[model samples]
Target chain A: MSGSGPGPTAVPTARRGRRTVDLPDLVARARAGEARAVARLISLVEDASPAVREVAAALAPHTVRARVIGLTGAPGVGKSTTTTALVRAYRQAGQRVGVLAVDPSSPFSGGALLGDRVRMQDHAGDAGVYIRSMASRGHLGGLAWATPQALRVLDAAGCDVVLVETVGVGQSELEIASLADTTLVLLAPGMGDGIQAAKAGILEVADVLVVNKADRDGADQTVRDLRAMLTLGERRDGAWRPPVCRTVATRGGGEGVAALVEAIDEHRRWLDSSGERARRRVERAAREIEAIALAGLRERMGEVRGSVALGALAEAVVAGETDPFRAADVLLAQL
Target chain B: MSGSGPGPTAVPTARRGRRTVDLPDLVARARAGEARAVARLISLVEDASPAVREVAAALAPHTVRARVIGLTGAPGVGKSTTTTALVRAYRQAGQRVGVLAVDPSSPFSGGALLGDRVRMQDHAGDAGVYIRSMASRGHLGGLAWATPQALRVLDAAGCDVVLVETVGVGQSELEIASLADTTLVLLAPGMGDGIQAAKAGILEVADVLVVNKADRDGADQTVRDLRAMLTLGERRDGAWRPPVCRTVATRGGGEGVAALVEAIDEHRRWLDSSGERARRRVERAAREIEAIALAGLRERMGEVRGSVALGALAEAVVAGETDPFRAADVLLAQL
Candidate 1:
């Protein structure tokens, strides 16, 4: 497995007979900014293919370049519109953009069919843009396991910026935080979204608070409400205060969208100056590593779950023969 | 750890010096309908106290009776108000009811600050009702770990029906599905909540679709939208079709509320008659056991994370000496 020694590829006969994947070739193609190769690597991550570990290893050297931004909010918050506008803004600045929409819907589903993704087809003609949607269909470890690897694919494929868009309402929101350098929380005016945002606990993670659909009647009031709420919420000393910005994303308002990009840049600058970038990256890697470790253990546990040893232990726990903790220890020991 | 061998109580010399908790005594009090004892036990679970394993062991014999119903919706959709109304209806039938409000806002924050809990104080004088709020502040396993243990405490405390209320906007909603015998997805008209519900990916988990605040002008529209969405979403053959119901919960409308209860009872009967009850329970237990196992491993991983062994492995993986898979294998082997 060590590249320093005889690489995993050195034993060509053993590798070819087993998996038959030219991992090195794929990695080279991805590094050369081939969209198809990047997509293939992400597909492998999504599918949990056997060669994914090798892919991760191959892509490690080129993983840290792209700026990853997370966009999240409740339904109808114009996440997709904002995402599209941001893409255009970055493209105007001559940056290659990648969009990874993490669907918070059912696992049996796929793609960014959310109508917002449909609007993003404006970028489809540009080879410099790539869009992918990932669903947590059968993923037990959820976004914590899959998103990082996908981001790595885009990063190594020479994307200048990658936007991670997810519905900002669950455990996945936190996972997005780990993968992103900046997180934008979008909300629409009216419908009591300001209160909803606070209640849903997304306020704490917002690096930039965006009230999309700024032309709505209550947009100013919502912005005010958010500012007041942030004041009441605790803030760390010397921490960057999340700016409240309004944007009518559908209208392609350039200044508002550019301000958002500026906010992201400032946050990135702060992250760098405060030494939080390396800290966040290390934490993200640690989480990704732990998620992989847990996923592996779960696979082992699945095989042992209904085995005689586990069933007996479960029965013993139920029948007052043993405690669940002790039984759990026994199960882990077996693994 | 096996009760059949020598119970944890028999090792008083070993236990008394470390912790003086009397697990059997507390369990007995909880069974005798002592709210204080129940609260104490739940506090232990929330605190993740070591004695919780013993508490779980003692209470295991009494946990199967309660019918747990999970009620969730957006923040201002009157979840708390509807919950209070339902609790009153259940209390009218001479049944003991317990409420566990899973607060996504903050983990250190507890109790019913959601205003609906304040309304539920209408039943405060009634000894048959128990209300507790749980905060998911720092729990990494989120609803997967703390909730089940808390539900068990309420179940063993002689409640006939336990209402597990959570703000239904995230991964906790799915966790609630596994815990509840029936799930009610509450919506209010006028806020595009129906679309939000669908977008939140919670539509698939709804056993009962409730449009609260039906007096609002868009109440009918919301109900219609939900029905249309349900028509389009996939449904398992022979599975219960969620019925959309209207209710003005704060006014305590009897007939509408009664119909909702009837739908719940009908669903409960279907669960029993169709054996879905057993199947869901099996799946739920599997998830819980797996969560517990992962939690244990996380504790082990925490110890190993920055330690010499894990640090060395991480260095190897980052420096391209080894892939993360093999590095993870090394870490797990040490655990």
Candidate 2:
């Protein structure tokens, strides 16, 4: 595969019979800021296609280090609205943006159908914007394995900032935090989200705390509650404390969006100045590599699952002749 | 480890500095109907202790093929009440019973708190019943890695029946279904649980559908909705259709308890007659073996994670000289 080499003058298509995917040409188009090519690349990644390794290798040299901002909260915290506002704010600054709405809990890709369409349609005509929704229906490693590849696609496609939005529940919250440079944990007033967030351990992952729908009742009380929670933790003298910002995302003309953007920018500055950006990037890369290796090992195990050796071991276990741990050792030895 | 064989009069205790655990004696006592020994064996499994392999090996020959029944539903669905009632009925029949309340979402082992304490107190004095709560706080593979070992502990302790109850949510619902011989998906009336169950794909795993809180209003509506949903799917000839049962669990005189037990017995007969019991057992054992193997592989990867080879690869990826897939391949080759 590496012998093909990646360059503009190289053969674009490696044809396998009648089916053809010009991965090199596709990567070239995506790097040239073509939305269709970018969407197709993301589709390949989401599908876990056989050529994904080739695509990744092709896109590696084009990565521009796009800023990744993760937005997560409970189901009804105005995540889509806040995301729309952020997109508009970024577009106003003439920056290309990509959005990946990852739903690890849902088996279907219907995240775009639930009152999010109208907001997302605002970016439908922009050539500089690419939006996609990925569901964890068939993924073996689920969101943790897929999201980073999608993010890499956006970064190599010349996006200045890529926003990843997901429901803040269970393991997905922490998974998102690990993949992003700046993590925003969104909440709203009168939703009892403060207690739930704390219980979920969502507070520790936040680089910015966003209280969307700030015009609603008890917004002040919500901000005060967040402040109280923040003060309970001790930080080093120069450590970056997550800033709590309030926004009425439904208001016309993007009310309170400027301050939120400024907060993100400030966090980015801190990350760069403290050498935390390089550190986080290296850690994320390490995790991505580890996930891929584990996935390969799992695939190998799945292949061995149908072998007579495993069948005999399983039968021995069922017959009470051997324990699972011993059977596992035998199976691993065979692998 | 196998050099020390299990026997009646073999050396019981294996001393390691300040700690001593007698695996053969513990298994012997557990098989002779000692509740404390059973509890200690399960604690070893829960803690993922080094002696767990020995415990599993020692307990293998004493397996009694206990009936594994899984109870799962959303919170506030009276799971604890039904569990207590089932325990009472089983004990009244003079059968030894065990209950495992596995909470995969909670970081704390407080499954016995809330209103469950009052119901659980009814069984505190019974020697034939053993009840314990396990939280998936520190396990690398969550409930999937830990639950089966705990179940094995109970099964080898000569319990005629073991009830495994868990909150029916995203992944845990499916995990519980995989571990049970008979899975009861519980629903309560007027809770909007029907739609949620359908969305979570919880209905497909049920061998028995239970509508608890049968005395409440809308009980008939919930049952009808469940029946309507069930009929939408097609089943093959001789296939066992899940029976929908109603039970007012809080009522005195074990309301509907006899009928529920009868239904479970009927399902068990079908499983035996159709050879599915053996099939399920073999499949369950296969899964347990696979989970153990994957966990062992994960530990090896974790060890390699701190090595300089992985660090260099991660740095190369961050510098855009390599992709994660290629880095993962290099790491796996090193392994």
Candidate 3:
């Protein structure tokens, strides 16, 4: 409860025991090769405190420099393999990378699939590389409540490329679409009819279409089907061709993954061309700012949202006694 | 430009457009034998409008008279066919029936495949029936924005039973899950691998597992797989055993259809005996009340929310310069 809402307005004036962190200094420390400092900054961001807002506000300019990418698709589509390749690709290019592999495997279920986190353990020893695992956590937007901030932590930590691996095919993937600079939708062959269902909303935000394990049988049919679907489903703006790439991520067969990277670069150009992407970027910024203020607004007025008279008004609204307009006004006036 | 955000002040006087709808009224109207009213009203709910809220707000006490059932699966699972058969079964029973078929197929698409609406035209002229085609107008929680409101329309119109046919695998199914009392997840045996992917999130919402087109190969395997998956998955506190039923909907070989209906009846008794269904009804009531408040909030803030500043603030919020609470404060402060 202490950090639930915006920090206490009065107590906020005094800093002791608040545990609200100084992210800018930590960010600088992390940039100076201190992983612990980067971790501390992420902890602060997850802290739901107004002071954290102040830190985020101060760090926003520094954080926006990194390129954020979201990788998503069906399970068994080699997203982990693709992600590992991505990390290697970026690291080979001398860029620091951070990876968040978010899947929903129950912690209590201990077996073959018990710990998916191990798929990412290859990054354990690599310098200039950081990887973490997250759960479904029921965050409808795909990431955790603290995910965007965690991304900001990486952003602040000076990771050149931050990759987000989504929980798959839900609203959360859509949420990740909004969070990343480019979204790569990974689809394997043999989904046949399921792709029609997948082409609809947030999943379509992908800047690149990755067909992993393409060396397998039915690759051509899958590619043809995907191409037909993509063709029939004209890009709303033709902003990007949504190029399909064939990759055998396991053997690293398709080493020229740089083409997909180039597509993202071209998308940035299109963003500049139509100015829509720039507008989108600007919109993202505003959301981040507003997120700061509204994080604890209602909680700041605790019990106000649950008063007796207010409760009566809510019932009246329900009972058709008075309009909801009167109800909200009465509540706002009380506040 | 037209409909956005909570406006300043509060709810305007319930002038003209307000009281036209809601879930209960639509439900009542549908029960009263108003087909056109039912169609239009379903749309109103699908839109998630205040009109729906108003109608729902004025809702009277409703008995647990109707069996609200949902049919869902990957596309091509013959949900539409199964639904048609299910309706035919109800018609055979001489019961008043309602079907809300969700058609995510863009009305604009001119393909050889009969529009889902046309495919479902079988129930069009029945005196004892009402049929509606619902479109997922973009943002997909599923019940079309108008579904709940339309459901009310059907209820008031007096359909003894209501069936919602939803998209198999889209986020739109979530809409049906939230609205339906009993959800029947339809699957074709061939899409076995796809089933594993779906089992992650949408599967657990099923009250009944339907493998339509039982004449098709892999029918037995699909049933067995689903049963194994169901058992491997955890059970809810009052969760009904989602009896997996096999039916060849296209062939009129749906002999097992009656048992599916009986399972629903059995589940309803469980609802009463275990008190879980009552708990759900109470929860739905709470949700209905919340929806009312949420819908009326925007109409109340007529001016400020409609202001030019919104366009500007949207940009600013995206820019990360202005905090959303401060934005709300400024907007509200105008009142």
Candidate 4:
């Protein structure tokens, strides 16, 4: 309730009413590959702008074209490095690329050790590449609620490819999988005893497994451990058995990275031919729409959080005069 | 549209009046320390039954007596084992204990290796111990939505303390922290290089850090690493520093279990004396109420998901005739 409030008043402050009627031109510019337009649209989504409906409506037709790829791994697994490498590959293929570093550890904490942005500066000057860091900390609904809309903005902005990178902690990877056509789960050598992988449930979400930092000690062991795990996973035939690839993303030496690209492309082909693409799209849309609606409801509840009606209901329920269900009913009806 | 729809009809399938008028009986039974009643009420909440509001209203006054403790760790950290040990200790202290294991890894398989239940069967026969396994796999909104309701039932059921254990993957641990007065973060020796602690953001949420399986090799190193990280966290003066304790839970050994309990008690005392308890409870209630409202809104969206209005709006957005924000507005307005 501290952050969320009732109805339109709960719209993010930055999004209150900067440009409610200029959505069509913005969408037009975004579709024509305007970076500022693209950035502005993403800002609107991030801010939960009231004009978001107009923005989404205007941009929907231009979307469903970009090939969205999600890259996730444990922290310190070179996800940002791998993402930058992939962005280079896509750019080299003459495709405009967009990168959404979801939940970046600290892009906001600009300092000498700002490794993420520093390492990804290869395309800093390339007009064909757009790199954006999304902080889930302040965003309503966190990554799951915010990423899809950001992706939509990217897709509609005429990016031929969009790569989403998230740390594989908790539901972040699953959320990434739901949004990405190709999900690359990265691991590194000697990072752990492979216990985290099993615990993290990364096995279920990977379309491609990349053992990044392949030049490090125990790279083979890590790859073997992952392969053994995948085999134990016993993915039925015809299911995508995630292929394991190794890469030294730091050197940019193209060790198994091209093969990784090929794997991603093959996955794209499979998705298209098997109609999984459409299915995923529909599912993504459903989740996105549901999140938006939920966000709205949460806002309404925020307004009602400390209201007299809600407080009395809580008190009644707390005092055992009524149950929470009935109390909620009265509260909801009041809202 | 495939899953979400327009309005209240979409609330949840189980809530379509399975037993709308039997609220008072269920509430009474639950409050009177009936396990079956408690379970039934939780089932209603989980199923998003229409009677949930009544259940909440009925049970509200009898709640807030139980101290909720959250236990979480990476897989293989002996969370279930530690929880069993704690339950043994609490029972010795003559307190009713309830355990809610969120995100049981294999609730879907319904096969063996339901490790949590299997491991926690030590207290299975004790009437003083009520252990329930929550399957987040099938539950909507995962831990965020289902957990608070379950906790309420446990609290109202006269459990002096409820222990909520979640797999420390993704956002589960954070959710637990929000609900618990004290959060215990479990770790094991030789599990990883301790990088996960930083990546998982476990350092922030931990109220008590237990190095489980401390008898194993690298136990000292793990504890040292955790302590070092804690020191690096740089708590200001008067900040409660999470103390790292060692335990060999499998041995049912009393190495640091008592100290851990003391730490939990001390944390609870701090919570109460610092006014954090009231703040946390309010925040928890706010989250619970908001989740319920959002659940309702989601149900409504489900009703509208495939409806003509929703389909047309989706189509309109897809065709770029309108933007998603505007379309969502129309959808919400219709609801």
Candidate 5:
């Protein structure tokens, strides 16, 4: 399907093989505070091949154990501001951090205007904190596919905490739910229940609801409305209540948002404890297999497109000379 | 990998001698105008089993003989209104018609609210008319995995023309481009540049730009703006020139949009002349193979989910001792 991303039509022509890029060594260097290696590795994974994907999958087993947190919200709701503060807090706790700010639009046009991309001021020159941004054009599942792979890369790179950020744009934001261990849904004061949010199905799945820019007017009212809606139904997973935390991220007023972070960790354990994790994994595995199969089936369709009997069969159906059921039966028997 | 859909999760436990479903017979019944048979046949093909999907691969070649025209745009732009008008015209021209409405909403809700569905009063009870709605919950591709298979059912059912009505929500509408011979982007006048329509990727893929509700004021201006945009780019397929049509579908004014339909037929001939169809069919075959592989991989992922190797690998990655490339390799190898 030709969705937002380019199709697999761009044939590399080069014989498919494992990437020459030394991911493990590059990751090791990043762990030793080599920023360039980490940058190269990110690009390497972005443009990876099936063989490279295989290699990444193989090595992911031994990567660092880090609680990967995904922070997402509508654009301009202070997600970057919130993430910057959180990074500082984690660093203060003596944890090396990796931040992958995923913004898809910038990548498409940046081959010429790429200079403007270095505008992220938070960690441009920080050795201790590694940060990268990706475009959406080549991203299949947006951050979902990329984040999981990138998380393992950072894990091997010695980052104790990997923070992923997504610019939530309408229905596409749901991609975050699949990627994060603890997905925080960031909301601003007084935006209320947007007509767009209701249509997109975002309000129903927030793991940790955060009312950021809390210092603004009407913060309490917004929180109140969200709480009222959340209270209308019993929580899906009772162990983790999505507590609404109010945070003034810029001035670090609610720097203790760590408590909310802790709650998410608690929720993760609860999910595993309740067998939901296993259920989800099984479900995902099945879906992945089915999706890939359908994709593959579509690819291999050419080999059988020209069976002489096939055309006559369809024409017979169109001519009402045969019923569809019998036609399918005949076709299956031949196949 | 798997979101919410009844995909094949657990590996099939039955003997592999034959499929659980009688596919060809079911397809034949669908061709004979049985809605239930059509639904069941689609379900049989949308599976996580390589064998069942092998049926789809075997069956796809015998299908896809009809002229596929896609209709889509932002919600409440009166796509259903335009669709009914187009259907009536197609019928008057003596074409056997089948309408596949791709609705992302749950089928249960849609069926219950069928009264609210746009009523094609003229063709409501016509035996030649077949209508079905598809839910968006299943499959990795927003287009149902069974769609190509279902297309076969309709093609074998004596359908001379097939109209694909898309939900236009998420990226499902974009997939319509690849599936259809002609794609009509229905835009209502006066709602200039809605976030949905402004998405450049979709705009670029449209084969025909349609300004619906053309009777409303400022329709001319909207048409001017749309026409201006159409001339700005080199089109996706070099030989085809996308055209724009304005329609007041409710009154059926300016309803003669069949010129684009003829253009699409000519384009098919062009593809054959340039040997593009050969390339397209080749890629299609590859997709079928890919889909089958994906399903097989997912079904086998269970064998590795709870293994000590999985746990040990995850723990190692958690400890920052491995890279993702190696982890991916290990996981796939285990599968």
Candidate 6:
């Protein structure tokens, strides 16, 4: 069986003087609740390491299909606080939880913001919780390619729930929503957030609407505005309506967090009973497969990019000897 | 000879009772400076019409490789006003200009904002000027696919210079900069925009910087801040350094507009003298061709997305029967 599995040549060999990575051993350790092992697996995924394919293959059978919840909001709407509160609530409930804080706006990777680090310190000593931050790293489709793999690492490591928190802005918000089983769109009062959300078209992706800092003035008005806006868009009679839950995330004792947790559970139940959970998982897996395939094709294209063949084709297009579409066809043929 | 070109079968046939596009005739008229013909050609590109491949072939030989100038800044930073002022300056110099205002944030297409319409009225009747607004239509890689094709339409329509203006937000700013021969990063007073620009990494794409609303308070401070930031980034010994230009775009008589035009021309000269123009165009064409080819592959992937084969593969992955990378390989084989 070992010989029939990924052969020695297929696996990435260790460099001189470096310790060989036994992926199977790492996966076993991670499954046994070793935080260091889990972190190492995620690091490999984040780095797009050559051994990632083997790592994925090793981790496959152990994955429990952890429930994914996405939380997104504009900066300073208390996303970190809300996420911290959610993590604490899940830990109190005796559940293993994971958090992936994705910062699409930041170009650097692995550096969590000072506030995120401070808030995450609450779970520092708790083996039941894991938190990591991933940055864009300036590659085309970087987040789309890496985020799901990291989720898989945490999922296989026995986290029952994983929360993906992202700074909701153009493109990235929708991307994160697509990766989650449940999505929370957060807003705050006095931010003109209701109209802004409508304009951003973010309302369409919300599985749960969160008004954080709900103790602030005009919180009721914000909720009303969101409800009114939600009514404006027609939905199928039996479809799940995203519930609005108000939370003062900064309050002690995880104020309003239990209600948020209940809302998540209700959405989960709806998903299961509606047969949407199975359907969504299939869809998500399909997307993952497609993304990986496309990334492979893109890598091949990159190889052809500055080659003499492509240079000649591009020069022909620039010289008006051929059109870009035809040039592209010639190049694609090479690929 | 006509048969030797893109065959009649390749041309998109006119549906019953619908007028034929006559792409060849449209291209001819557009080359002869007919604005309606130019608009028709661009519409075909924007719609991603089936005839686009043939249209590109028709327009290939006529393209003059128009100079592309990209203008981007945050909203309320006078992008439209500055664009208007630049168009006036170019018109005064007897150079035909084209403007493509791309709003990636807007979900609707072809609907220019009221502010844009009012500002564009400055040259409403000028046949030498062409202005169009392109909005994101929510497709994957929408702007990346369409904007370059539209630029081709305008370049082939005999514009001396084509200006692409986009809101300087996440991702779109970098996209527009990549498409331009010269990129202008605009800022205004009292927005703390210098730090914002630095944080966004927009400064690295700027070939020239503009301080619009230069008459406002803190304009000098803004300029100083930008200069200080620019100095911190190391450049090659002989690399072209971006110049900071001050412009009150709304002022009458096109305040500082001539200097801005001169800066653009100077940059053009440097692009030519440094062999950067040839290098940049080749790189841009390579990217454009790559985008078109990837889009074609994406279409094929879309076809397989819901197929029984893909469904089985996705189900297997979800069931832990296989990893996504292996499933993706199977799907790629089918493609």
Chain A TM-score for each of the predictions: 0.87, 0.89, 0.76, 0.87, 0.71, 0.89
Off by over 4 Å in 3: A1-35, A43-51, A57-284, A290-335, B1-32, B48-50, B58-64, B104-121, B138-141, B172-174, B193-203, B216-239, B287-335
Per-chain TM-score (chain B), model 2:
0.89
Query: Per-residue alpha-carbon lDDT of model 1 for B1-335, expressed as tens digits?
Result: 01232211110011112357788898888888877677778877766788778887786666356888999887788888888889879978889888888877675534536453474446545667777777765454577777778888888888999999888766878888987889998888986477888888888888999888889898888888899988987778887888999888888344389989999999999999989876666556556666677789778877877677766665564454665667777777778
TM-score of chain B of each: 0.88, 0.89, 0.74, 0.87, 0.77, 0.90
lDDT of each: 0.76, 0.80, 0.60, 0.72, 0.58, 0.81
lDDT by residue for model 3 (A1-335), tens:
11232222110111125454555676678667566666555545444555555555555445356677888776678777788777777777889887766664422111123223444345544557666555434222224345666676676666888888874665656767777777888877775233653555533676777777778788777777767777876666556676777788878424546666677677667666777666656555444433433333334334454456656664564344654434544555654
Question: Top TM-score: which candidate number?
Answer: 2
Model 6, C-alpha of B99: deviation from truth (Å): 4.3
Among these predictions, the greatest DockQ belongs to 2
TM-score, structure 1 vs. true: 0.62
Q: What DockQ was computed for model 2? A: 0.51
lDDT of 2 by residue, A1-335 (tens): 11132222211112123236899898888888776677677767766788789988987776548999999998899888898889889988999888888877676553334534564456655666767777755455677777888888888888899999988877888988888999999999988567667777999999999998888998998898888898988998888899999998889966899999999999999999999989888888888889889889988899988678888898899898999899999999887
Per-residue alpha-carbon lDDT of model 5 for A1-335, expressed as tens digits?
Answer: 11223222111112223446665676567556565655555565555444445546544445436666778788768787788777767766778787777765454421222222322344444455666665544424344444555666676677788887777775445666655556788888766443335455666557788888888898888788778776764766455666778788777434546776666677778777777555443333333323332333333333344555555554554444543334444544443
Question: Which of the CAPRI classes, incorrect, acceptable, medium or high, describes model 6?
Answer: acceptable
Cα lDDT tens digits, model 5, B1-335, are 11232332111112223346666676667667565565455455443334444455445446456777788887777778777777767766778777777766553312222422444334555555555555444543335344555566667666788888875766766667666766888788766353346554566667777777878887888777777766776557656666677777777433545654555566667767877655543333333333333434444555566666666555444444554334444665554
Interface RMSD, all models, one decimal each?
A: 3.8, 2.0, 6.2, 3.8, 9.6, 2.0
Off by over 4 Å in 2: A1-19, A69-144, A161-177, A182-234, A241-269, A304-309, B1-18, B71-94, B101-133, B136-144, B165-174, B184-233, B241-260, B304-307
TM-scores of the candidates are 0.62, 0.78, 0.57, 0.60, 0.63, 0.75
**Model 4 agreement with the true structure over A169-259: per-residue lDDT tens digits:** 7688898988888899898988853557877788788899899999999998988888888788766656777888989887844667798
Model 2, B1-335: lDDT tens digits are: 11132222111112124257888898888778776677677777776789889987887765538899999998888888888888888878898888888877776553334434554456655667767777765455677777788888887777899998988876888888888999999999998556677777888999999999999999999999898888887999888899989998889955898899989999999999999888888878888888889888988998998689988998998888998899999998877
| Cα-based RMSD of candidate 1 | 11.0
DockQ of each: 0.17, 0.51, 0.11, 0.22, 0.11, 0.47
Clashing pairs in 1: A107-A137, B107-B137
Off by over 4 Å in 5: A1-247, A252-335, B1-65, B76-78, B104-120, B139-141, B167-170, B191-212, B218-238, B243-246, B252-309, B319-323
Give the distance in Å from residue B105's predicted Cα in candidate 2 to where it truly belongs.
Answer: 5.1
lDDT of 2: 0.80
Pairwise TM-score winner, candidates 2 and 6:
2
